[model samples]
Target: MAWQGYPALREPGGRQWEASAVAWLDGGLWLHHSLCITEREGTVDVLTLIAPCTCGRGYVDITLDSEHILMDILGDLRPTHGRFPHCEEPLDCGSVHAAPRPTGWR
Candidate 1:
């Protein structure tokens, strides 16, 4: 589904990060600053923000319960990959490679 008027996340200092990706899985919503992989377990939602690591071999995986928390995580990522580039066309969330695994699969 195309998100109409997709929301942009603003840092406490007022910098804005446009949604590069967004999705709804198992009744929970997600917004990503960059390309991401998502998974859900019962009531918990885990998102892996891909390619923000300077090492080029690392990724940040986080579990969040609110959009604010997700925004905070994205804000904290500024130092890792610098400011997010302006998205000309956001990725279709439904097309994102969200692979749901069994609980405790690691």
Candidate 2:
């Protein structure tokens, strides 16, 4: 079946993009990170981060990976130490994997 939410697409010109998907990194034990692709638009030129806290806040939208997407998120997580701003829950980066598309994402 087609993706329920915004699905990955390939343009007639052969450019490809996807709307929302989680990006994962496995770091020995404590450094693992999960960069949630909460929002993607405009040929996937822009991406927004999903806050791991209980408030459901989102980070500033940024242009799609200039270098590497996972590296960017890993850098951002460094400041917070994987702690969400308004919530106690931490992202299960080690367990989370890049999945098929997410549900209820716009």
Q: Residues 7-105, candidate 2: write the lDDT tens digits.
A: 567666576555444443232112222234545532323343433432334322233454587466657667765434453345432224343443333
Residue 100 C-alpha lDDT in model 2: 41
| Top candidate (lDDT) | 1
* Candidate 1: tens digits of C-alpha lDDT, residues 1-106: 4433334466565655554455532213333434333454243333433322343332333446577876776677555443233333444222234444433335
- Model 1, C-alpha of 28: deviation from truth (Å): 22
- Which candidate ranks first by TM-score, i.e. highest? 1
Badly placed stretches (over 4 Å) of model 2 are 1-19, 25-44, 54-73, 87-106
Lowest summed lDDT over 10 consecutive residues: which window, candidate 1?
Answer: 51-60
TM-score of 2: 0.27
Give the CA lDDT, 0 to 100, for residue 58 in model 2. 31
